[model samples]
Target: MPTDPLERIVETAFDADVRSCRRPHSGSVAETAVLELENARGDVPRRLVCKRGGASIWTGDAIESAVLRVLEQRSDLPVPGVLASGKIVGERGSARETDPLERWACYEFLEGTNPGPGYATLEPTVRRRLVADAGAHLGRLHGTPGLEFDRVGGLARGENGTDLVLCEPTGWHAVDSDTLREQLPISVPPTGDSGRRPVLTHGDYQPSNLLVDDSGAITAVLDWGNAHVTHAEYALARAEVRFVDSYVGRLSRAERRRLRSLFRAAYARYAPLEAGFDRRAPLEKLRWVAQSGSNYARLLGDSRGRRQLWRQFRRLLE
Candidate 1:
């Protein structure tokens, strides 16, 4: 097999004559390949993750890099450490210097299994414990004193090298049933100047993004691609929906009840959501799913998979 041109470009990225580079799986908005890097002596090799974003997807790579730095400096969150970041000329020093968005970055590779889809398959006791553990970790993340922001929503890099904003397309308003019925053609219900304060959220915290060791220990929280600032309840609802979904098709009703009990018992310690969280959760879930539709569609990579997302999206609206 001939050396891939992309691989050569990534080699120039790390400035090392690499050994092997391969894509681990299909990614939605970015193409990611795991590269085993050799040190100067070529013996002490390091594993790194290389990612190149698609043309239209701008999920704030710079912001994510900044978040990773904050996590590395401030918390014990198990996330990828940024290795080689910032803009680089594609095929440096060549005739085709290329666009800035065509840049790439490297991160420390994480190793573990994502036990999301088969979460219910674990022993009953283990499932219960994992839920609690997940809740505690989420609480820890939420407990971190969030960065100061002027408003609530997605973050963006500013012209002064630190311009974060409360981006509108980020989350939804917690509207009532009547509002759901009188819905507009807008993404989320209209709630002008609602003072729901923003907090640091995982943006897409769920079982699938968590990596656990064989011993059932949570190792790393992967994919900060969707991490941003949002309403605390908005984050909670998105996570809760995912928790229920993991067991929905796999377990019996009684079994699901058992797990839900365990999940909420732990989640309560962290979330400040009121009794109406469930009533407002559907709208919140819909908000997240809609904004993330393209990313997930690209991850699905097929018509059938994309249709499944559409089905879910429409159901949420109803």
Candidate 2:
């Protein structure tokens, strides 16, 4: 028996004879709950997860659910099945307003913990295998040839194909334009290449998004809110950074080197390394990095200070 109003929303959505609904503290953008539903006709009930959208960062739940449905129908990727979704109107925010400030979607609960903790204890061989498998999955996503969406039409449907870089205000912001240009060593297009060709991308493909069973095999990849079609190289870069960031602290110096080598090797096997891809090119890399930083600041910053920080961070990275 839950007292929270949101918990009641979960119970009502499932029409589940819910024995209990326990909220889980895992994600930042959405409210997640693990519900135990009782089946009157059978001995065992059902266990499902519910995700309710929050303000600021998670305004795309409806669109994300639609995209996930499309992906599950077309691709063999293991994503959670969407159950139901709608505008949840309630009392909150303003007295003048009739609806709540948030929207929500319910999903079939996935059973498994995050791969981050488990990955730390993995044997060298196992880690290599996981990396290789992840690379393969990424390759398949990137290699989904001829996948197209009507850019103009998608926008109408609230499907933003471009990666949103929010600019926010920060006190500790440093690194000037020249410094940023000097640090990054890669090429950046005026606009992202994703608009040109649309390939499937799990917008955020970090260790936390992957789920592994007791034996350590990745059973499912959750969270499709950020998944969309994008440029292959951009997606690859995102994946590379995620993989590296996840394992960096846990690995020894030698192991870190080996892992990087393995990651690049595995990635290249699927998509040949671009001839002039230079990791040391500060100008290009910094531009992208700066864009990312600015986006973060913008999302978290208030209107008055957001633009200032965004400009400074962008210039510094550029």
Candidate 3:
């Protein structure tokens, strides 16, 4: 049996020989790497992306695998196929409850490149299409059914294994300031989705998570680590920020509005926008601000920095 974590997971999952493994740029919550496997039938090797989660309630191999099954079975969204997944076990194949629970999963590698952080610098036509398509894609995702949960929080498999349940929102811990912590407005859950059923939301819908081909159409929506059950309007409002308004400082007001209009128009085809979005969107913007741990950590000790973020937060409301 392979001892190295990567090789162990891959070999255990796929029964394939790991030729090489390389670390790839991944999200803050999960450690992700790509492995090349020697194909027995052909000289070429197969590639798979493996994700390992630390002891965080927000992510795990089982949670992510469950979410992917929903998208694959219920929706038309292009998500990677889960190859194999399980919790890390001991050399004797027994897992101790005292040990820190580390879970891992491997997925078939999708072909495409991330658009990077240059949303404002892309060619005019390409940027517009990408934004519009992303909006539409999210609209479809929000409209996907089979996501039934009583509370507004992250998702976890139910006792039946087929159903999903809501768990406490731990994703907020990443954004909560060490000083202010949950005291910040960003940490407060939005109440706008009251009386509405929680929808399946891609919590981190942004350029970095999307893979695009030469035509600029989204090839795959990557990263289910942030998948959660939330209000449709709340999800839509948050997506608008991720897709457009997060560029507030870099984009002119008129330009931002134009991009937003394009996105809303496209999204409207699949889902309806709520009348209360104007009030809800700003809160989403504040949430986006606190997404960066390093940035929030810096603000924790710096009153001036906290004030600047508050000012921006207030402006979003205005």
Q: What does candidate 3 score in Cα RMSD to the true structure?
A: 8.4
lDDT of 3 by residue, 1-318 (tens): 666777877777666788888775444245577888874234223888887752223433246766777788888888888776666765654454222236677777899868855677777677777888888998787666665455566666665543556777555422222345356553433443431446678777888788887667888888776577766655676678777777888777887888898887787777666655565567555655554464456555665446545644654454
Clashing pairs in 3: none
Error of 2 at 154 (Å): 9.5
Tens-digit lDDT track of model 2 for 209-292? 787665555677776654544445555655666666446667777876676567656666655455444342233334347646
Better of 2 and 3 by TM-score: 3
- Model 2 misses residue 81 by how many Å? 0.8
Report the lDDT of model 1 for residue 241: 65
Displacement of the residue 277 alpha carbon in candidate 3, Å: 2.8
Candidate 3 achieves a global lDDT of 0.66
Name the lDDT value of residue 149 in candidate 3: 52
Ranking by TM-score: 3, 1, 2
Over the stretch 1-318, how does candidate 1's per-residue lDDT look in tens digits? 227645665466555666777765423234567776664244323677776542222233345555666678767768888765555554767633444245456677788777775676877666666666676666566656555343455555455432344455432432232356455333432232221335666666777777777666677776665567666556666676676644566778887666656665566675443565555666666766775665565546755345545644654454
Model 1 segments more than 4 A misplaced: 1-6, 26-28, 40-45, 54-62, 90-101, 148-150, 160-196, 270-283, 286-318
TM-score of each: 0.70, 0.69, 0.74
Give the Cα lDDT of each candidate.
0.58, 0.54, 0.66
Stretch of 10 with least lDDT, candidate 2: 150-159
Task: Using lDDT as the measure, name the better of candidate 1 and candidate 3.
Answer: 3
Q: What is the lDDT of residue 290 in candidate 2?
A: 66
